[model samples]
Target: MALGTIFQHDTTDPLAVITAPSPNESPEEKAAREEREAEARGISDLIDEELRAERAVRKKEEGMVKILLLGQGESGKSTTLKNFRMRFARDKWIEERASWRAVILLNLVRSANTILHALSQEMDDEQFGLDDAFTFDDYYRRYRLRLSPLLQGVESNLKRLLGAQPEEIEPQKQTHPITLSPRTSPEFFVRSRTWRNFLQTTRGPEVSGCSLEQDLPDIIDSTEAIANCKDDIKTLWRNDIVQAMLAKRRIRLEDSASFFLDAIDRLSVRDYEPTDEDVLRARLRTLDIQEHELRVDDDADAPKWKIYDVGGSRTQRHAWLPYFDKVNAVIFLAPISCFDERLIEDSRVNRLEDSLILWRAICSSKLLSRTILILFLNKIDILEEKIRDGIMVNRFLPSYGHRPNETSEVVKYLRQKFKDTVRHCSPEPRTCHIYTTSVTDTKTTAVTLISVRDGVLRGYLKQADLF
Candidate 1:
């Protein structure tokens, strides 16, 4: 019987002989053959549709306005990028929260290690222009015996979790072989799935046979200890000896270390999920350019925005050139709070001074002259805090003559300075908009992003003859 007979009555008439093919062919065979052909044609049509859709998507992307984020390292480029994701692509950002756990842990552990280093330096009298506040021998002895072990434990844990550098791996080859260094390896962040897996693991990495501490603590460990022992950490941090030593060494402890220090209790919990603010505060040096495609609207006709964030270190500046020609606009972030700070790579160079020079280079560059330039005078929150804490702007920047050491005064002075720098160096002498921003503040940053999007789109639409 023919399969078609299952769906419809099988009837035969003498008139049907006009459509009959061969007398030897069975009705069932012809029915099954026609069904298979139908399926093949349906699949072919679906495939063709998919190919056309992909081509259309690619074509749309080619016209998407590309915005390049440019600034010095630690200048909040990554944080601004995070703001865009949170505002426009919340679903994807939520999905990646787990991966950021490792980064947050890494930042905390690094801060602890830095504080320990400073303490060690004080013990050795390595930092000049510092008087020993601990006249009693027991203060030194107790801190050394107690805090030293904790610091050692933290460092050992960090090394274990991050994996050893290529050179250090051979030394521990029997235990854990050379994979990649999360702290130093540029490729690990961008390419290594092994590292990414380590980040996503819930329980944390298994420590090898090295029992430096009874149990290697995770981020939770450091946070718990710091929180429970808040008084101890605070006393140690604000001790005249530590403060004087930090000041002499010009270490910006507040910027680098305060995030973990401030929220020690909250971060220690095993069940703790990182909030948007936590993610913003979490510091990881971006080692390469990251590009994210954002959908401004759900409609298929909506436009796409391509945002690029590149590493801003001195060596990383070379990578910026490759992206310059393609960008429709550039958002340059200069952390104005860094006026009193020095670059980590070069202590002699003032951070603000370095930023100004980088800005000048960018503005004057022939490749970027026609590119829309928007400056974010970023980290205003930190600047306001520093001003309140009695950090005089003129002390570091002598050019600011007779200005009051207040937030409003400092902002005004810096704004004028930035505007002057742009005016003096911009190759095209066009008006550049500057925004005082704290990238960590989502609501404010989101609003700023909206304006920025509109401005960039206006310029881009005009260029594309769409306006």
Candidate 2:
């Protein structure tokens, strides 16, 4: 370069003068500059280390399989989750088994109290006429009186202990106008995690410093009360008049998950232990999203798993969208047994129709379009029971159109309807596996779960090109 060009470049750029070392710099100035450079490097390395640690934790979580169970209320999402935990996380189940005793007792007391209220409603109804055959006479009055204290004492305290409350039954404007007496409402559902922690609280011999006398009275007294009333329970449940009253109101207590009325004899025993089947069948409505973790394979080589179970009620659905973005699979359960039943939240809407609408929304969700879709046409057992009792599918579902009312045919029809929804409504073509499941039946569900877990892992791995 020419001398004139070099001089011009040095004058034009002002930063060169500051960044360049002085021609006559002292040794002290050089040492200070080098020291500053070393400190900056140290700071930079610390930041890089923090970032690397955060990424490692995030990657580990992402590497594990994540499943979300989606469905409407009482569609067996909790039961399905229990199956996964029971099969893969047996140790946790075994540890928690004894704790479920209190829950089962609460369920029994709730059922008994419901029957008394129903009986009282008829007797108090002036419209039924004093001369009605199903009179709430002195004999029934004695049973009601006997059960009241036991029910009140255990029900309230127990519910408070477990952090749950009784659900209100409201009369809807659209459905048949039937007044549900407030006294007859017995469904107590968990509204908070306090009850979940109650399990741990009940596990040990004592709670805090309290003695067994001042102990969780509900836990101790429930069995004795229910046992003393066991004969009375059997009598009330088997009474023809009581049955007639419930039947006239179109209330089928037998069909609900919380209905353990039939097992009073076995359950009333002093040392009653809830069997595996009992735990799966116990119905306590989950109010919010519940997270469960399990190692799917044996500990030596198993991958971590995260399963999320969300409450399926209309109000709870708003919280579901955020979870749809990064899930491996979403198990959608539609209870076929509810074909003729109305939703508890809205009596005017048919439960089956609500499920179909929910399914359509899920299929159309852009966030879930890429997620694996697995449909469980759940509660086939109840569907078959209804059919055997002469319930015609076409009567409830007009479009069903005289197709044979057999369970296989009904399942096939519903399966196709869901399949078409995914095919047409989804943003893109995706694979959806449909399984006929009675999720309450743990044995049958075990097979379906294994097939689903393997299929989900393979599909997830294939998309990641890790297979």
Q: Give the number of the best model, judged by TM-score.
A: 2
**lDDT (tens digit, per residue) of candidate 1 on 257-322:** 677766656665666678888887776553556788898657676568898988888878988999
lDDT of each: 0.70, 0.77
Estimate, for each residue in 1-467, the C-alpha lDDT of model 2 and write its tens digit: 76335444474467865565555668999788889879999999999999999999789877777899998988889889989999999977866666677667767776677677667666766446555634567578888877776555766656655665333222122354335632235346675476567655555554323232333455666677778888888888888877778767665453442357888888877777788887877767656789888888765554678999998888899999888878889999999888888877777888999999999998998888788999999999989889999989899899999899899999989999999999999999999999999987888899999999888988788867889
Q: Candidate 2 — which residues are off by over 4 angstroms?
A: 1-57, 126-134, 164-186, 205-217, 254-259, 299-302
Q: Which has the greatest lDDT?
A: 2
**Shift of residue 319 alpha carbon in model 2, Å:** 0.8
Cα RMSD, each candidate: 11.0, 7.8
At residue 245, give the lDDT of candidate 1: 56
lDDT of 1: 0.70
Clashing pairs in 2: none
Error of 2 at 149 (Å): 2.6
